[model samples]
Target: MKTNFLAAAAASFVVAGASVASAQDADAPWEQSPFRCEPGETYVMNVMVSGVEYWFPVYEMFKQAAHQFGCEADYTGTPEYDVNKQIATFEQALAKQPAGILLHPMNPDPFVEPINRATEAGTAVVTFAADSPNSKRVSYVTSDNAREGRVAAQQVAEDMGGSGQYAVLENPGQDNHDRRVAAFIEEMEDNYPDMELVGRASTGQDPNKAYQAVLSLAQANPELGAVFMPEASSAMGAAQAAKEAGGDIRVMSVDVNASVLDMIQAGEMFGAINPNQGTQGYYGFLLLWLAKHPELIDPMNDHAEAGFNPMGIPVLDNGYSVVTQENAESFYWDKYLKKRGTRGIEG
Candidate 1:
C-alpha cells in the first residue's frame, strides 16, 4: 500500500512539473506568445512636437502597457511643429521596420500615403490624437473634439451670464483643431442665442501670434467677454494679453500643461478642457498590437486578402474632463511626474 501511494504521488508531481514547464515555455521571450512580445519586437509612439508636456502622460501609459506585455517601447518625434520634419522623423522610424507605430499625424491628408505605405509593408500603424482618415492606418484613439468644444462653449457662455461677445484663436489646417473650432462655433450659434462670435484669428499655435491675436480682438471688439482656442499652447500668451487688457476676459481652451494648470489655479485663466491622455496611450498600444496580430481574429471579413487591417476600427473617443480652479491641483504636470518617478518622455 505504501509503495502504490508513493508511485501515485510521483506521477502527480510529474504532471504538475510539466504544466509549469509548458507555461514558462509559452511565455519565453524568444517565442512568439499570443499576448507576449518576441525578443527585440519594439513599438514606437511618435508625435509631432516631442517636447510638449501634453504628450508625456500619453507616452507614460503607452510605455507601461508595452512593459506589461514584455514588449519594448520608444518615444520619437520632432520638437518643431513642422509637418515635413515630423514626416521625416516618421520615415526614419519606419526605415527600422519596428513592430508597430502609434502616430499622431500633424495633419490628415499628408499622412495618408505614409501610413498606407507602412501598413502595406506589414508594420501596423495606429494613429492617436489626430488621424489620417484616408489612409490604411489600423485605428485612431482620441477624445471627441466636437464634444470638447461644445462643453467649452457652454462653460464660457454660462460664465458670461449667457450673453456676451467671444473670440476664437485657431490653428488652421489641423484636423482636430479645426473640428474643435467648428464645433465651438456651431454650439454657440445653435444653443447660446445670446452669445456672439466677435472674431477669429489663426494663431498657428504660436504664443506670440496668440498674444497679438487676443490683443487685436480685445481692441477690435471692446465688449469681448471671452476667448477660446482649440489648444493650450497659445493660452499662456492669450492669458497675458487678457491680463494686460484688464483681466476680465475668460481665456479658455482645450488640453493643458504645467503652465496652464498653474494659470488656472491662480485665476489668471478661466479653465481648460483636457483629454484623458492616458487612455489615448494605453488603448492606442492595444489597437496597434492587435492590428499587428490580426491572425488572432477569425472575423467574417477577409481583411488580409482585402489588404486592410483586421481591427477595422475608424476612431475611438477616450473621453475628457474640464479642468477648473477647484480641480487644477490634480492636473499639475510636476506633481504627476514626481509620482511617476520618471522623466516626462525622455526615458
Candidate 2:
C-alpha cells in the first residue's frame, strides 16, 4: 500500500510544475506529519580524500539515518588530499542544492566564506571530524582531538616505561591533526618530562614522506623510544621505518584503517586513537536535519524577535576508542563491511 501510494503520488507530482512544488515546500505543515523528508529533499556528506577507508563507516551510518528520514543522501569529495580541489568539490555539491551538507573541511580558516555562503543560502552545513570554528556552520561533530592525543601519549609513554626519547610526525595545517600533535607534545612536557620530544617533521599525511621522516629521525635519535603521528596513513610508513631501523621504536598514531589494524595485531605498531565515526555520522545528520527544519522548535529565546532559528548546538563530541592488539580483530574494516553487507564508501 505504501509503495503504491508513493508511486501514485510521484506520478501526480510529475504533472504539477514549479508552482505546485513551491506551494508544497514553502507552506505545507511538514511537522504535523511523520518526521520524514519532503520529496526532492537531499543531504550530502562531504570530505577530503574521498578514497580513504576512515570515511566509510561514517557514511554508512549517515546513509542509514537519511533512509530513516526518507531523504536522499550522497557521499562526495576530492580523491586527492588537496584543499583547493576539495573546496571545488564542495562547491559542486552546493550546486546540487541539497537540503543540507555534512562537511569535513580540509582546513579551518579557508572554509569560513563557503560555510557562511551556504548558511545564507538557507542550506544547513554541519562539520565533522575536523572543523571550521569561525564559520557559520550549524554544528561541528567529532571525537575530542586533545584527549585523543593525551591518550595516545599515555599509551606510548607507558609502553616506553615513561622514559627515553620520542618524536612526532605531523600534518601542520589541518586543525584536528595540529591539535592532536600539540596536545601529545604538551602532555609529554607536563606529565613525562623524561620522554623528550627530540624531532618533528611534517609528513603532510603522505606515507612516503612519513617513511623518510622516521628513517631520518631514527638515525639522529638512536635512543628514540616511540614515534607518534596524528593519523594512521603516516602510522603505516612510520611502523615500517621503525621496523627497518631496529624494531625498538614503538609507533603510536590516531585512527585505524585495515592495514593499521593488521599491523597492530601483528605487534608491528602500537594502538591508535580512533574516533567513534558511527556516532559522528549519526549525530551529524541529526544536527543537519534539525538545523534545516528549525520551524519544529520555538524555544524560550529571542529567536523570533531576532529572526534566527532556535536550534543551535555549536559542537558535538562523538567520542573516541582505542584500538590495540587485543581489540584489533574486532576493528578490522573487512569484518565490519562483511557483517554489515555494504559496499563501504565506494557507492
Error of 2 at 346 (Å): 3.7
Q: How many residue pairs clash in each candidate?
A: 0, 0
Clashing pairs in 2: none
For each candidate in turn, the TM-score is 0.90, 0.90
lDDT (Cα atoms) of all candidates against the true structure: 0.86, 0.86
lDDT of candidate 1 at residue 149, scale 0 to 100 = 92
**Model 1 clash tally, residue pairs:** 0
Residue runs of model 2 more than 4 Å from their true location after superposition: 1-34
Q: Alpha-carbon error at 122 in model 1, in Å?
A: 1.3
Off by over 4 Å in 1: 1-32
lDDT of 2 at 116: 90
Clashing pairs in 1: none
Report the Cα lDDT for candidate 2: 0.86
